[model samples]
Structure formats: structure tokens, C-alpha cells
Target chain A: MLPMSDLGRALCIITGASRGFGRTIAKEFSRVVRPGSAFVLVARSGGDLRSLQAELTETEAGRAGLQIRCVEADLGLAEGLERVTKAAQEVATDLTEHVLLVNNAGSLGDISRFTKSFTDMTEVNSYLSVNVSSFLCLTAQILQAFPQRPGLRRTVINISSLCAVKPFSSWVLYCSGKAARDMVFRVLAAEEPDLRVLNYAPGPLDTDMQLEARSKSGDVQLRKSFSEMFSQGQLLSCEESCVKLMKLLMEDSFTSGAHVDFYDI
Target chain B: MLPMSDLGRALCIITGASRGFGRTIAKEFSRVVRPGSAFVLVARSGGDLRSLQAELTETEAGRAGLQIRCVEADLGLAEGLERVTKAAQEVATDLTEHVLLVNNAGSLGDISRFTKSFTDMTEVNSYLSVNVSSFLCLTAQILQAFPQRPGLRRTVINISSLCAVKPFSSWVLYCSGKAARDMVFRVLAAEEPDLRVLNYAPGPLDTDMQLEARSKSGDVQLRKSFSEMFSQGQLLSCEESCVKLMKLLMEDSFTSGAHVDFYDI
Candidate 1:
């Protein structure tokens, strides 16, 4: 692992940076990363990402030459992936000392039992494209763009979930997509020992995904379980989860290729 | 479990039935299934399935009123899925006593180390589409097409692999796709108890896939390992694997939702 000082010159590329854990993590990184650090924020909503850029730029670290670039593109499409890849590469050229990737964008798609065929082909395709294929493409692009730069700290943190390991009642697509994402990172970690790859499961955080799960109509049991979890204050706040994640990211004790949970930390 | 006599009137739908284990399984079914039974064969190559149909029709089972329908369409595309679904439904209309769906189609999708940027978006999409989404869609359609008819045994056998549980260096897409397939069947088994879902891992078979793996260019270690396995005569022949699979399919002792291996039986 590179020294913490090298992080000052790190080029961090984060997907789904407009909201939820993505936004929270961006804020945490902005506060913690030193001057000369650059961030390339990617998401579907240009307005949301622009607003985030404004917020980050107003911070003290931003004033200290922390660069912020927003690339508004849907990760579900090939064109969007190309755009993000170009943006990431351009930003990396400016800050080549260290590179970090956060594949955080994901979709729950239609969360329903197999009996309920609510999810169409397009939705399923988008889910796999965004969650698995796109992530793999971007990671590959980044790895290729920076080919063994001496003293450069290369790290990838895939935001996975409990669904990766456990099979849910009505979350077949989501569970599988996340599981694939984790496996991709696991394989990458094995193939590239110099690169740090972590499949980080943030646990059940209070986010839009929770709201979506609670509101699903097809699976009554699933909705009830989510509602109960909400009522019992079982869901961790995004702020708390981001703090723990940031801590984990900064620590050198965490082994590469490890699938870690926030609760475990 | 349904009685063996029910197999006489069973409507078995097999995907990737043109070659390899699928073709062997189709042959096995042709020999065992009594007259009045129907087989719906789906694959990209129409000619191959037609030849198989002709061969089966020459046998005693075919002469005894066994109906064979070949659906020449790719399981990776929506149009192909629609065509196959329609064909299966049409075949089911005539032989609706017992419906068995065999999701045997899959793609390795440019198997290479994660460090090697060999797999493109198209290949990745095809892998997920063919292995996971298509399988899910077909399963869902079959379940809907033949809803819980009393005395109508509904069984879904998903052809999975050991890669589903173990992560390999160059088999990221294949591993994840098979894992997703297994999880889909697992979920279906839970949601639809009336349906028997089996995630069957045939082990390493002496099929085209093994040959392809042995000849892979990106990973020497992976290729060498597969070659060693082949030289050691560890890979099971397609005929041998199909025999074991047929026995398991006919057995009443095997429970629904069981992920079975050929050696275990």
C-alpha cells in the first residue's frame, strides 16, 4: 500500500455519485482527501451530479486544489460506458500518481417473486448491464489506461451487498447481479496482485433502495420484512455507513480481494 | 414425486439440444420416454436439431407416437426466446400431463483473466443474456404457461457448473452466470413449491466446452489445468454424464431445490 501522502495525488473515479451512499462517500472523500486529489463523478442525472460538484467545490479541500469533474452518463449503455471511460482516462492523465475506482451504480430492477413476471427483458438487461457488465468494462478500461505506473496505488472498491451471498425471496436479479459484481472483483484481485480490490457490502443502509424494497407490491412478505426492519431502526444511516467505509478504505490492514461487510468492521 | 408412468406423457423442453450433453440427454429421453411423449428441441442450429429429430424418429420410441419439434433460435435474444417459448407452449398444448424444462444453454463469453481485457461489452452482454436473463425469462414463461395444473408435474432442471460455487481466475463471466442460474432455480424452488427445480451441475464433461477451455489463449495456467484433467481421463463423457442425469431425473429420492452433481448420485 502506498503512503497516505500519495492519496493527495490520487485520481478517484466514482459511479452513482449523485445520491445515496454514492453521494455520501463522495462527501467523505472530499473532506478527507488532500490537495491535488481529483474526483470524476459519474451518474445518469447531470443536474444532480453538477449540484454535487458545486457542493464539493465549496469545501476547504476543493479550495486546496481538489479537482472535481462530473460525467453525466447512464452506465447501462455502451455509449455511456465509452463516455465515462474517456472522462476517467482524461482525468487520470492529469493526476497519475494514484488511481481509485468505486463501482457503486446499481439497480434493483423489478423485485418480485418468480411467479410474478413483472420485470420485462429491457429492465433485466439494464440491471445486468449497469451492475455487472458496465462495471467490468470500466474496471478493465482503468486498468488498461494506467499500465503499471510505478509507485501508483491502484485500488478498486465495488459496493456490493448482503444479497451477493444470501438469496432473497424476490430479489433474484439483484442478488445475482451483486453476486456477479463481487465475483468480478474477486477474479480481478486474483489476477492482479498489485491492485487492491475489495467487494465491500455496506449492509442495509437507509437509502432509496430500502424505500423501493418496502414499496414493492408483488411480494407481501418482502415488503413486510423491509417495513419491520425500518420500524425497528435496523437500517444504518448513509452517513454512518459512509464513515465506516471511508475508514476501511483508508486502513492498510484490510487485505486485498476480501469481501468485507461494514458490520464486520 | 410423480410415478415413472407419468414420464410416458411428459413434454420435455431442452435448450442447447443441438450438441454436447444436451444432444446426449435428448437421445436418452428418446429411448426412455414412451409413446405419446413429445420433445421440444431449442438451439441456434436448426439443421442439427432436425437431424437429431430424424434420428430419434427412426427409433422405437419415435415409432410409438413420440412427437419431436425443433426450434431453431438463439436463446440469447428476445426474438429467439419468444420463438422458443411459443414452440414449447404449442408442444405443451398437445402433451400437457408433465412439463419438464431443461435450461441447458450457456456461453463462456471470451474466457480470460480479469487482467486481460479480452471480453468486450457484446460478449459480456451475451453471456449474461444467454446464461442468466434468458434462463430466467424462459423459466418464468414456462411456469406461467403451465400454471399449477393438478397432477401435472412441473420440473425445471437448470444445467449449472462447479464454477457457480468456486471462483476461477479466467472464468469470471461463466462463474457468475452459472451462479446466477443456480440462484434463480433456488428462488423458484422456494416461491413455487408445486414445481420441482433442480440446479444440476454435470461436472467437467468431455464436451466442446472442455475442449474450448483447454485451448484458451489468455491463461496458460487455466489451459494447462484443463489439459491435465483431460489427459488424466477425469472428464466425464457426455454419454456418461447424461446417463447419470437421466437416472437422477427419474429418481423419486432427489428433493426439489437440490443442486446435484453427477458423481454424488
Candidate 2:
């Protein structure tokens, strides 16, 4: 993914900025957007977001149009959303025009049940609240916060998963959470046809989350299979995935109605 | 559909029994399921449930082994879930072994966008609460409730729509709600391999809901298209779809994992 920003002077608020793909997207934003551009980094860990803020702020390319601010919030609760909202409001100058909402924070629930196990319940609730409810609220608030700015475009990129379309065994909560999240975007798009909403299915990526998933799976055979898959280089790099996402963000031909695959676009 | 005692002596719970598919399913259960068997009917309206209960209990087949119990409660909130849980506890009898949970209640949110309208918020929040959260809680509770009495076979039939797989243009809330519900069942199947879960896409059905949807779509061209589709026999009768569903329930070879299409099975 080349570093170029056509989204000039736009304020981008990315959740899950502490690590994984969100971090990569934020970095890309820093590289592409011009100097004096503002970014609001949201995550559960304040220290991690602050570190990334400092890192992005220190780069020569980052200094071009980048101003970083970090906000710590669970992003899964109402209070968390309020905090993010408050921070976005406080840094009002960066958010004058279009708002880019990237709902990237999510969890893969305990993958071991047809029955409702305790682990499954907690994981399912947390995932739904974080991945679906949080996205819905944040998107609604942003739309309300910044009504359509003339000559400026607003877009929502919901970082969905390939598991949404594929029936991967043991990824029940994760899969459903994603599917639900996709539906939210679909519904929102249908309601506001003009809104640029993308349910971005980025496929698989070689990330720490996958490693953590493989380890916590508990099933030895399943862990071995995942390890084999990961080792076979079937996963996308964070940069590769982010590049595709950036391309989609730049493309004007695609509308806000479909579940788009990164490779297809 | 022909009214057979396929369920025999098993216990079943059907929500949204005040009217529509919920009422039909409860009646069908009463017609089948041998004498002395339990069928707990849940709905929001008590008067309607009492009348339905009287009709079911009066049947000769009902006299054999069918014990119809009506529990009035809205399956749309935490209080509703608590009500249903209490009802489930009450319905548990010495003969109650296995349980078949049918999560069939559905709603169509405000058909019009009506931006900033209270209707939209009510429709969105209510639909989310009922069509997703309540159903999920129901699945969770039933799964947890059935673990007792070992060797008890449990089945969760999530009645989905064709729109779940194929995106619809205007029925934003209805289509997305069903889509999310279907994904919940998929997640359940993935999480619990032992449970028999089916996301039964009942295709387009000639139900009141469909008629209401066709009328309130606010597009003349779309209504005509929908009518043409139905007239062309694209829609199936409830009896036919229900029979297909019952067949899936009775069949032993249809292994469960994720979403199972009625057409495919």
C-alpha cells in the first residue's frame, strides 16, 4: 500500500488503534493526510494509544499534516462512547468537515459451543456490545455531530471479517458478531443511501489476534491446524490489508450497499 | 403440515404466540405432540393467549397428550426474558426431558426513513432489542436450561427469511434483523457442536407480515415486483415451509454446524 492521502484535512477517528489493523490504518492516515491534519485515536489502553500517538507524531511524514490525540475508552460501554464523544468534541477543529468512523475493535468469542456455556455467554455479550452496539452508537453520534458538510464526503468503514461469509467451525461468536455488525451497516446504508458505508471483509491476516486465538482454542488438533494455516502464509500482512482498505476508501465508484471484499475492489 | 404427532411426548416452547406464525406454530404443536406432553406458549397479549389455549385444549388430539400452557409476556426486553424464564421453570414437569426451542417472533421497523423522527429511533431500538437481543437471551437460557436430564435431545430452530442471504432494498430493519438472528443461530451451532441448530430460511412466505411489508414499502415499482414474484409462485405456503422444517427436525442425517438453508436441506 502506497502512502498517499486524498482525504485532505478530514478528521479520522479510528477505534482499536492500540494494535492490529487499526494501528496500521492510523499510520497510513498519518502518511497520506497533509500537515495540520488531526487524528483521534481510541482504544481501551491509554498507554498504548499515547505511545502510538507519540510515534506517529514523531515521523517526518507524520509531521506533514498529522496531529495526534489519544483517548482511552472501553468503547464497549455507554460511558466509553461518551468519553470518546467528549474527546472528539473537545478537539473540535480537526472535525469540522467529514468524519471517518472506523469500527475495528472486536473480539472472537470462546469457540466451543452449540450450548450456552459461561465462557460463550460472556464472550458473545462482550463481542456484540463492542463490535455491533458500539459501532451503531458511534456512527449515529458522528452523523448527528456533523451533518453533511458541503463539498466534503463522510464514510464509515466497518472492518468486517471473511468469516462472515464462510462457516468456520469454532468461530461462532466471532462470526456472528461480524455478521451482525455487517447487518448494522447494511441497515444504515439502506436508511441513508447517500452515506458511504463499507462492510469491509479484509479476509485473514497474520496478526497477534490470530496467534492468541490459536493458543486459547484449547483443542490441540484445532491449534495445530491453525498453526499450519498461519505458517503456510495464508494470512495477509497488516500493510497489505490496510492498502486494500485505503484503496477502497479512495474509490468513488463503489456504493454503500454491499458486503465488499478487499480483493474484489 | 398435515397435523401429525411427530413430536410425540417432547416439550416445546413457542414465543410470540398472540398472532401470526407464532400462533400457527403453537396450534400445530397442539395438534401434534401426544397427550400429556407440554407446549408452553408465550406472547405479549394475555387475552389472545387464553383464547388460543382454550381452542387447543378443546381438541381431541389435544386431550390425548397435549398440555397447553400459556405464558403472557413480551419477548422484547430483560423483563420479558425473565418472564419467559419463570414460565420455563413452571412448565418443567416429571415427563419433561428434551426441549425444542423455536425463536420465531419477528418485527418490521419503521418502513419510512423519516430522519430525526421518533418513529425511526423507536423502530431501530425496539427491533434491535427484540429481534436480536431477546432472541439471543432466549437461546442462551434454553440451552442452559436443557443441560439437565442427560441424553435429552435439544433443537433450536431459528426461523430466518430469504432476505437474510439475499439483500433487500427497502426492508432495512426487517431484513437486517432476520439476518442478524440467523447469524446468532450460526454462532450457536459453531459454539455448541452437540446441539442441533438450524437457521431455516423459510423463503418468501404468504404471511400477514409479507403483505404488510409489500404494502408499506413506499415504492410502487417494488410492490409490483414483489407481487409479480409472489404471483409467479416464488412464495411458498406456511404449511409447506413448516413441513420442510419438521422434516429437518425429524431427519437424523442432517448434521448441524452453521446456517442450513431449507432449500439445501
Candidate 3:
């Protein structure tokens, strides 16, 4: 794991951490953060988040009172984004400092059929709403609430996917949605140089979504062909990627919010 | 001008056509469309559009009774999208085959300031409403009402900007919004191969918005820089770009709505 030296005093808000990468990110931050730093956990599953929060409190990096605030709300809709933004702002106001916003929450819809017919309009619409629209809303809200403050060194890390750069037949919606998010950060970083914005593509890993996609019922032939991609047993654990990400986050020399791949490390 | 062959046998609906490229596009299509085709123009300026409809009828493209229907409504809001969609459906019903959806209406807010402190939140928010969110909503509604017929080809052409691929320092919000629209087309094309969903980045054109931006008062350095960019004659004319675009649309070889740039052709 990258040593968390500079993060001791940083304030972070991570979304979609109920399980998978979000959970790993929060726990890792808790372990590395300085004694006075704050970490906020956001997701839809309150119960799972509470358990994860408790687990975070036990880590050595968690000693900073590691103020953990769990706000359970769906990040898929406009209302959900507003609720989280309000809650996050309250935390920001209490600390009197801008935050390191981690736009990590997302959805991985069924990948079995690849392209569903118009009859699947509901699914396609939902995918666009949650995976793409919500990110834009959340970004706008955060930027509007937190204006630039001197010496704050605020940052926004938009978690994207390798699938965004390469076209995946089955993940048409998900891949393109992430690509949209990637562009959001890219444009924002160029507009505001002071604010560090990173569009990250965490390569394929052992996440719940991947596991589910691998086993989805569909054309046995198609599934068999796709499954071979993950069968190489090279999937990175969330912890490994989180550690690498933290390393990048702590480094003062890196460009702000470039679309980076974990495998590149 | 690319001849609008067989367009008279069908219907085409375009949003945001009161002025700018939208007005030019509607007129261009009206010229080449089959005398029997219908062209529905949607924008906020009803008075201007009504006048335009009459002028269009004087052309040969209109001699064959090419219907011109104008719907004046704000398309940035959800209600507006629904209203426009309903109007579009009414026009589509009159057609024998299907409808071609052109999401050409867009805006680029003033970019005279580099610092967010001097930025106008209302303007940025408005840009998102029109350029980003509403594109998806309109596309969804169109897909819902889209006529499904065997061996029939339907297309959704999204007019994007060169700002989508490359970032301009002061145009973050506009760039992000345009990029998001392109991403939607990317996903839509992949999911529905039958529907010709395309995202084309029409290069910088001499539009009223650009002129307004050039005349804005703000950070002297930034504003002067932008003014120079315009003064140097770096922008393309709307008619020139439209002619190029018409070539692509009529070529009929661009099967999927992949992101195409004018220079590429």
C-alpha cells in the first residue's frame, strides 16, 4: 500500500462505498489519514455502510477520530444527488474547508443481452439516468456549493472505467456513460487549473458487478466467450487499486485529474 | 447543397432552430426534401419561425407541398421536451414511413472569465439544461414514438461541437455538455444498430453566441485572448459547415452514429 503521508489532514467524501471499491477506498483512507482528518461514506445500503463504518473505525489510520459520516441515499436520481450534496455541504461547513469529492458511486446493469430491444427502454433509460445523468448533476452541485478557496487544494476524482476507452459489446450503456463522466472531468480540469480533477479508469477487478456479469444467463456461447476475459485470474483487488490511487492522490507532481488506468502503474 | 432526395416522402423534426445553425439546417433541408415531405421546426421564437415558414414555401423544395410546422416552446425543461415530443409525433403520423430526428439546437455560454469567482452560475446551469440534459430526454421521447417498420431506416443526428474532443480554457461547461451528448449517441448507436444514431462535431462557426461572447466584458487578458481568436478568422461559417454535414447525411454510408468531425471527411 502507498504510504499515506500527506493525507493526514485531508478531508474526503467518497460515494458508492456500501461495498466493493467504495468500501475499500473508505477503509484505506481511514487507515492512512492523519489523526485530524474527516472521511464521509455515502451509498444506498445503510446497514452495509454502518457495518463498513464500524470496520473502518478499528483501523490504525482511523485514529484521527476519523469522523465518519454515513448518508444513505440513492445516487441514481436528482433528489438523491441533492440530499447527498446537502449532507456533504453540512460536513464541509463544519470543517470550514472544501472537500476531496470522490464521484465513485455507479451502476453496472445486466450485460447478458448486450443490446436490448426498444422493449427494454425502461432498462436503457434507467442506465442513462443513474450512470450518466447523476454524475453531471452531482458535479454541478459540488462545484456550485464549493467555490475556490485559497490554500485549500481541493480535488475531484471521477472514477471511470477502461471500458470507456475500449468498446465492449455487452457493456454499451455503462461504457459510454463512464466516457461521458471522463469528459466532464477533462473539461473541468482544463477550465480550472487550481482545482485538481482526475478521471480514473480502474481496470477490471473482482467486484460484485463483474462477478454478476460473468454469471448472467444468456447466450451460452456469448457468455463463454466473454467469461474468458476474466478467467485469466489477473483481477486486482479493490485494496490494491485503492492503494495505488492513494499514492497518486498524495503525489504533488502529477497533473490534475488526468484519465488514468490502474494497470499503467 | 446536398440534394435532399426522397426527404419529401418522410418527415424531419429539429429542435432549437429559431436561429443559428438550426435555422440554416431547417432551410437547407427544406430546399432538398421531396416536395411531399414535412419539416417541423421547434424553437422559442415563434414570430421569426412563422415568417421563415412562409419564405420557405416560396422555394422549389416547398412547391410540392412540403409542410412546414413550427412549434414555439422552451426545450430546456422536462415539460418542454414532452410538449415538443408530442408535436413531433403529430408530424410523424402524417408521414408514410418514419421520422428523422435532428437534435441540432444548442448553445455556448460566454467564456470571458477564467476564474469561477467571476462566472455566472445561472448561465452555466442554463447551458447544462439545454446542451446536456435535454438532449437525452428528447432522444428518449423520440425513440418511444419512433415508427418501427421492417426495412425502414431511422436516424438521430446529434449536432455536437469541436469543443467536445478538445478543451478550450474558458468553455468548460459548454464543452462538457456537448461531450455528454456525444457519449449518449455512442451508447445509443451501440445498443440500437438499426437506428442510425450519430454524433458529429460541427467545428466553430460564426454564430450570434460567438459574437456575443466576443463582445463580453470580463478579465481583460482572457477576454482579449478570446477576441483575438475570433478576430483571426478562426471560426467556420454556418452555411459552409452545413453543406459539409449535408454531404455526410446524404452519403448514406455512415451506418452507425459514430462521432464524426467535419474535417475528417
Give the root-mean-square deviation of each candidate in angstroms: 2.4, 4.5, 4.7
Estimate TM-scores for all models.
Answer: 0.93, 0.82, 0.81
Q: Candidate 1 docking: what grade?
A: medium
- Whole-model lDDT per candidate: 0.80, 0.70, 0.70
Best model per lDDT: 1
Docking class of 2: acceptable
Question: Which has the better lDDT: candidate 1, or candidate 3?
Answer: 1
Is candidate 1 or 2 superior in lDDT? 1
lDDT of 1 at B264: 84
- lDDT score, candidate 2: 0.70
Per-residue alpha-carbon lDDT of candidate 2 for residues B132-215, written as tens digits (9 for 90 to 100): 767877888877766745656677878787767665555655666677777767656655666777777776677887787677
Per-residue alpha-carbon lDDT of candidate 3 for residues A1-265, written as tens digits (9 for 90 to 100): 2333666466787889898998888887776556667777889999998998888878776544667788888776566777777776766543444367888888766666543332233455566567655666676677777777764657788888876665555555566567667776776676777787888777776888777767872436545654786787767789889888888877745577577889876
Displacement of the residue A223 alpha carbon in candidate 2, Å: 3.0
In candidate 1 the C-alpha lDDT for residue B95 amounts to: 46
Better of 1 and 2 by TM-score: 1
Q: Which ten residues in a row have the lowest lDDT in candidate 2 chain A?
A: A113-122
